[model samples]
Target: MERFKIRVIVTDQDVEKVALDVRPQTVEELKEIVRRHCNLQYEFNMMYEDPDFGNALCNLNNMDEVPAAATVKVVPLITSVSPEVTSNSSDISISSADTVILPSSSRTQGWPEVFSIPNFSVDVEFRLRQANLAYLKDNKTFKCPWDIKRNILQVLSEEIYKFDTYPDENRLHEVARALIGKHPCLTEAGCTDGCSGWKNSLYYKMGNFRTKLRKAGCAEVSINSSKNTPGVSKGLKRPKRCEVNFLPELPEREETLEAVRFLLAEEMKKKNPNATTVASKMDQTFSLRRREIVDVETPVETLKERWPALFTERQVFSEFNRIAATNLNDFFEALDRYTPKFVSIFKTKGGGVGETLTEFLQQIDLRKQDVTALRTLVLRGLPVLLGDDPSDFYKTCSVTDDDGVWAQVSIGLLTVVDEDAPVGPNVIHLEPVSTAIIIEGSVIMDDLKSLPEALCILFGLSYALHLDYPKSMKNTLNFIQKVMLGLGHNKLPPKLQSLKNVLLS
Candidate 1:
């Protein structure tokens, strides 16, 4: 028996040169030799570079057939038991380490434990089966046909849409890696991991798929379509700060659009409406409302006339629940929980803004103030901290001149009063007085107790009516959407991330 050296790669940074006395007769024998040499105690799958496919790593099924001096990669299986793991004979365990964690800031958050690829069409499956059989018979590299690849992508795109309508770059790569892992024969020749090409193809396929979905009246994709978002040259309107049920499908069978609309209208007419019934009707009519708001781009006045209940405080919170899937109470509780930290962070700054924040903080006795007052203070100070001009977001004008100011304002917190309360310059102190949320120069929600409530309702209405974040308060709202409410994309902007890091620290 002649001795030869085979390079074993345990990880990207870990490689070992193993001396084999003789060619292993089976894959188990090869694993035993690798375990002895590398001192690996855990069960791991092996993939050896195949000269037949320009040295791309292929699953090492038969050690007897493996080429001499092959480079073998050892992939460790996840020790934690999960239902998502596929126990199929052909399935290889994808290491947790292999998954690319998005947004380096959030290290704990990564890809799902299992990336499930749905079955292809019958015809496509038949073709793939034949190709896979050929590859198994004589080590033939399966050249994926265009039609077969298209069908595979179609199925995968559908699966991706089930999670997110707009999957990021890392997500697309994860899907491609999962595809090649399940179907090793589809590994691209000359590629390092064998799925770079697949990733690129998937990116384009997703774009094409979204285009098709947009044309087919998919409200989620349609809202971000080019035609809907004119003048948005840089980026389309998408869920940046949260995973909103932007445009959910209409309720099936029992709850038709007309039926739900009628039910909702009847409930709205009640002097003291049933909260539970109103909430259910609002949820049922989510798709209908989304269509009018997103597709039709209905005016605020018209929307109020059609869906009057939507403007009510109860319905505003209900709409938020439908879109964000979070309770209004929970939002306030979270705001209250983080108020002290935010206040501390704000106090650390020393500048004009800091000085202003100091004055704002001094006006409110932290010990004496209720949760609502603290939350209001924090919300007001947030825009200032984030360097966002609060003039547009939180507007203050006398009751006499309110009509002119409301007309000019697009969306914000509007405070109309008989007399100017002397709190401080540029400071709108939180009072138990009536305030309103102005959208498109119209008061959609009114008779709010404080700024925080108005802000929460305004944030919810932003989603309900598909309105963009106000330019002046973009950062502040984004922070609220991403950090406070915990809705939106994983990757926070640098400014927000920095603030988050400080807050977390």
Candidate 2:
């Protein structure tokens, strides 16, 4: 038995931070300290499940008696061992070396855990960041609803700066070094930051923060992607300048996330014993152009350059100005559902997969409410996917192959859900054209936005799969309708708010 110092913080009567030493026999005890000490402010999220220093805690706030909802339902999505249940699973044991000792910084003034819904990515990193987000959402706000927004912003600020939860590049490299025998270097491939695309992240070594972490960092020969670990210089290889595959018959529904989630979910669970249903539920929460704030410590004024429309929109998108605006979540979902799943694999012309992915990440921009709506859509899609006949409802990333010899397509998607409404969910969708499709024809280019969702889905596949971005842009507009006819709004209004005010809001 080993003696360890444990501090569980909660808002007891006043803002109180509790510290105690725990002699834990098994891994389960780490969780118990969190549950009991946390009391009303409970956060037992496992960022890095090291069997070592008890489990890491989520950011907790406030103190209160157990509310009725807490006892009424224990929405158990992820599995856990019951302290009272005597069984094999409950016999918790942890390794001494892996325990997460509260760092000196964490003990004095605990830092938060921040996450981002990155353009390219990894699952573990995403989940690690999300654990704090889960706390932000679940934790209670101040009694006066007036304090809600301020409280959220405060939490957001703290969490976004929470970088310690997930590993940086050096950390990931260390893990890779353990497996590969040396720090792998990039040689031939053009580097784009890792675009694990959907469920991955770009990380750097804490030590390497001074250099261009996104570029190739190799002391010797370059490491091929199959052998390299994630978040490192994600390899991007360019295939010969190829024509877009001419296969017109591939069904669009084949590439949607609904089609892919289950297969991926099974694989993900093997790696994460605890990331069962809870993680899946969190995945359901993101939508087109969703931005989970990582490093929230950065103030809003700094983000204003990129997110100018937010403060300005309550300033820019009005019936006064003719600026066009559509439901962000809906528009992105539309694109995700109908867009062709394209890949610009490392074989693209002199480019590597990393660069291809970084390009994808750079294109995305979104409004806040739009993301919340995506969660609703994904959650709704989950049940259907787990059930039968879910193909028609797929996300439309990629489906029909181009009869084997056709050129590949590229895909980009945005799903935005407006969270302001108390009644039901709302979303908007968006997609941007890659440069490859420009060569297709003048006719397609003339009416780009009029294209249908399915064709746009097809067009998006041209990027990473190494089709041409310009070539597909023209082809993509084949179906986008300018006027959302059924929504009681014109295609492009003389004034943007005139359209938004009528239906979109």
Candidate 3:
């Protein structure tokens, strides 16, 4: 059994040691155990300095191969939004002249996740060469030369002034570390783990960077600036980290509809004999008719009230169900394409050999067929199949090849009373179900239609499913309410219109 231990560092400057047994458990299990023991947030990520690759994202997939007694850092994610900077000077302060110890809390605010930064690409070798930072030729001691550090600071000074606002201290640390790690000489100085010596060195560089910018007549706001004090972010309050609700003004409904109609009219009039003459006349009229673009600034509540049918989730789902059921055969066929083996079985042998639909019906005494069992199976299975229950794996057959699709085979057998003449469709007399049973059937059918079937099932089942319903379908659910009701006025091809009406009714 391969066994190893690692030092785990938390964001709150706490450290713990964790042992790993790679023979039995995977790296994912190791992370879970570490996460639970450390009390880290679920969203927190892990990183390590590989002997071969330097600093890299932890490969939880191959923890067994990692050398024993390695150290890993648990870094908090810097969300891709404006972060709140504390007003307390002592909490975060950068000296204008010399080195300062960066308060541990300062790392909490910078963009730590490198990938989130727009256009960020690290070319460590080029950076090291350009900065005069030394690389290990053999087994040399990891020490970043002073001249290299001074040159790096000079570069940082130029880079700082180019920024519109003061860069976050954590961002500077990350940027410095990226360059530092490439130079193997900086490893002993603790650049890989973002050591105190390296951090202090980076901070002094930033202090000089800020000082140079100030002296060059380019005044800059520091990240530690008080929100109450007037500066670059005078009226700027840190935006609340709530769900983003962007409200972009859109062209007015009437004008957009007119534009669509104008384009559609051009297409329709193209087949006319005097096409060129008509086209010019239509273009002239359309130009004259076009008005200034008005923007929709209506409240959501008002818009929902204006078009109640489009806004309600339940109603839209119901419509989708109704639309799907209109061409039920096509819908099932689409669903069948998703299950090729099952379809092949049905198509070749009428059903699976021994458990065939014909065999089940043959054994059934029409005089005493269990209606209760049939109804219970469907009622119980349909919802569980459509719902979010992971354990409902057994309910796969209820929606696909059930009575909804096999209506001719199953319903026909239920109607047949005589056992001798097994295949007489016209003479079969299905016993009268109670009005309650009929209603139950209707309810189950309704629920079946409203099911959130997969997109493949919708499209693969029928070509007719591709009919243009509305512009709302192009975007995600959030945009549904924003789509103008007038845009839905485009007449769906006859088949889609019928399907849509079934739901509306």
Best by lDDT: 1
Model 3, span 182-235: residue lDDT tens? 444555433446444655665765554443333232212222233324336554
Which candidate ranks first by TM-score, i.e. highest? 1
lDDT of 1 by residue, 409-449 (tens): 88888876657565334675667357888888877777888
Off by over 4 Å in 1: 1-152, 177-195, 211-244, 248-256, 259-263, 398-402, 416-420, 423-425
RMSD of each: 16.8, 26.1, 24.6
What C-alpha lDDT values do all the predictions have? Answer: 0.71, 0.26, 0.34
lDDT of 1 at 119: 64
The local distance difference test score of model 1 is: 0.71
Candidate 3 off by > 4 Å: 1-135, 160-164, 189-196, 219-505
Clashing pairs in 1: 241-487, 241-488, 242-487, 242-488, 243-488
Q: Estimate, for each residue in 298-319, the C-alpha lDDT of model 2 and write its tens digit.
A: 2333333222222221221220
Looking at model 2, which ten-residue stretch has the lowest summed lDDT?
241-250
